[model samples]
Target: MSRLYVILDVFADKALAGNPLAVVLDASGLDAAAMQRIAREFNLSETVFLLPPEDEDRKARVRIFTPQRELPFAGHPTVGAAALLGLMEAMAGKGREATFEIEEAVGAIACRTVASGKRAGRATFDLPRLPQPSGAAPDAAAVAAALGLAPGDVGFEGHAPSRFDAGNAFCFVPLAGLDALARAAADPGRWRTAFGGDLGAFLYTRETADPALAFRARMLSPGIGEDPATGSAAAAFAGAVMTFDRPADGEHLLRIGQGYEMGRPSVIELGLVVRDGALSAASIGGAAVVVAEGTLFLP
Candidate 1:
């Protein structure tokens, strides 16, 4: 048996508020089945297991797993995993930031780590920008019905429900008010059938309550049932709205609050810009505190 070191809590300045992740630093000799079993045992939104880099120039390879299945790309897992690997380097007396090439099912995701504190700190990786906007958009009536609301509940007369992906798929449903956002509840089975599949859904609305706050989001994922704060889906949601909402130039920062429903309220900072009729140079960053650090004994 070997010891498996793991860390949890990402995207929150303080611990225990954001998405919880389980990171396996050394995944050598663990077959796919074994990895899946471990993931099921941990039962987080996602679990990342590390593999040796194929090339010396590269960092480490990563495999992402959900309790039910494996995901090609996930935002929190990528961030948490990269930071964990960097902390490992810091532990070994390496410099503050250590870089790694995370080879996943999607592709090689280049990760860079920066020490944020006295402890081995958070690392970051800007995943390959693969935003897919399939024209198969969802209508407002159907979206409202799914959220147990009226057709008039969706925000803005023009904006329709849309699908966007930065790697993982998401449905950006903007509501008329925080009441509708908070009252959100959908039959899991019905939602799966209605939306096709749930990588992300139904971000809570806040500006309706306080105009200064652009939006408040409550994200629902069929994979984890619910995610406190979702970075990738949040990024996709921001991109989707720009096509319809059309914010003015120079307003680069979009503030979206998520996780209110889950009791672990989270905030995601999205810096975005659209250029030449296309979204480009979108940067998503948030604070993550190490809530728990422990080792797993693989017997």
Candidate 2:
């Protein structure tokens, strides 16, 4: 059994700034139960398991898990997995840079590797651009009650609460100020009851702190207990906002800064194009760095 495990910092240009994830290579021998146990042992936001790719064009077969459950796709896990693969290839005497794809639960994705003394893999996946968004201005009363804010305090001229997805789901809510967002606390019961499952919530607070960045978002899943950063939700959010807002002309490239409150302080860059009142494409890519490499031994 291969005992190599790699940890990566995703969405941050430098190590230690972004979300840290564990990637276990050669996980073919581990069962589903063992995978969950391994994820729990890591106790990070998420952990990725990589097996030999089913297709030659693909790089690896990826399975992502939180301590609670397995996920079809996730952001940091995707980046983390690719970084691990690139490092593995280099150590095996491969060349400097490479391009590969990972066959994940979401499907095959393109991953490009660049060499900067160390292997850093950057992967971009085509998230199913939902033609129509699931959005309706939630009754102001219910929305305000849920957020513990007055009806007038919550709003957006171009957007409303919506559910968007690449591989995971995001219930997007926009708020007035970071203070309002910081004060917003969710009861665990409300999550399963309102969301129908323990899934993703993309909550954004308009930031006066930095006008250039646009906003700060806090993604929460009571199911996982805590997540420093979330990549899947970030993509879903960029897609949702673009789909719902059909403008005459122009593009919205949103910079989402999250994890500050948690002290990790991740910065995510996302863009979506809208034209003739329709959504076109969603692009989310970020930098990653490998922080540590070690072994996890199981008997």
Candidate 3:
């Protein structure tokens, strides 16, 4: 059988910049194993399978997959898939700023998209769940060892190590500077010591390469070496930031710069609504461009 698919660049401000995502449009008959295989074949950080929504009220059902396994939820895939869907609707004469719902492993996700008048569009989604502490984070030394950095190179602005999960769990490691962020590399031997298993390690620093950005970050995992822009991590980080920074009640925004090391510099916009020093809500937003559309031959 053949399946229709679209390739998109998520969180990108320009073509060829940002995380690449492959969205399978006609994914009704494909099994979970087949989806994983397709994701592997694409060799990107993630792929999305768009199926008919199980719930009539939802716009679509999306399943996200890494090369190795299917994720309950993912950032770029959601944003990319939502943008593609919105663009399709626009081409069909639908108006801009469409609000829709996507059913995922994490439950129902509310998404809003605005057509950019270009080949791309912008997407924002309210987090299905608020982030909370997942587990005790490894000490800075252990995390540094896992990331191939010195203990002294770890930590800045009093932001130590922490673990948080919004929809996905991530070990947040705060680095001292951009130099430390740039030098980070995964050491398989120390990976277990840091995260207790092969888990997503989010390395970030306040010293951003771009003056306009609030932070510089990189996501390192087992199958996906390093993610250019990571939305899920940013979502969870918002929770951690709210916990640590405890910003005054109201809306706070953060512009994250990522993927520069891989040459696919990307931007992720995070919005947080805090009330009485607690995070009441959070949103993730970014731009996605439909880079290619084709058919996928599958067994």
Candidate 4:
């Protein structure tokens, strides 16, 4: 069988500068095993398979996968898929902006896309579920050890180590500064001990390469090595920001820089809606560009 696939750089305005995703547009006949195999073949940070939506009103049913396993929800794939779909629609004379819903294992995600050009667009989606604290995080010392950092480098200001889950769970570790963040590397052997399981770790610092950005971050997982940009982790980090920053009730937009260490340099926009001192809603938005398109042949 042959399937149509596209390679997109998510969270970037240009080619090869953000998290690259493989999107399988014709995934009707593929099973879970086949999808996993294809994802491994692509070997990108993540891949998405678009299927017919169970609900007719929805745009599509999106299944996200890493090289290792399938995910209920993911950030880059959702954004990239929406951008591609919206751009295609516009090129077909649909409209410049589109609004739709996409189903994932986490639930239905509401998405809005604006076509920026013939091959690029920006996409924003409301998280189906808000982030929540998953459980107690490992100690700072453990986290530091897992990330190849000193104990003193583990935290800064009101931020510390924490865990949160939006659609996926992640261990959020705050670093002291850009120097600490740059020096940090994940020691896979100590990962399980630090995060208490196979949970991925999201390391961030207030110091950013771009002054306009609010934070700089890196994500390391046992399943996927280093991600260029991580929307899901950014989604989960909303919990950390609410817990530590305590922004006043209203809408707040934050730009996060990631993938710099890998030379990809991507930006993610995180929007939080605070009401009466509590988080009511959150969104992830970014631009994506379609870099390559081709047919994938499978046995």
Clashing pairs in 3: none
Candidate 1: tens digits of C-alpha lDDT, residues 95-155: 7777767777777777777767644356556546746784477766767777777777786
TM-score each candidate.
0.87, 0.85, 0.96, 0.97
Give the number of the best model, judged by lDDT.
4
Q: Rank the candidates by TM-score, best first.
A: 4, 3, 1, 2
lDDT of 2 at 257: 86
Off by over 4 Å in 2: 87-97, 117-123, 128-138, 189-198, 247-252, 273-277
TM-score of 1: 0.87
Alpha-carbon local distance difference test for all models:
0.72, 0.70, 0.89, 0.93
Write one digit per residue (lDDT tens) for candidate 2, span 1-299: 54888888887767777899888877997888999999999988788998888996678899998887898878778866765677667767796566788887767777666544564655444443342444443454455555556666566665556676677766777777787777666667555555555555677866648776766887766655445667788877765566544444566667788877777877776766666666676656666778888998787
lDDT, candidate 1, equals 0.72
User: Candidate 3: global Cα-lDDT?
Assistant: 0.89
Better of 1 and 3 by lDDT: 3
Whole-model lDDT, candidate 2? 0.70
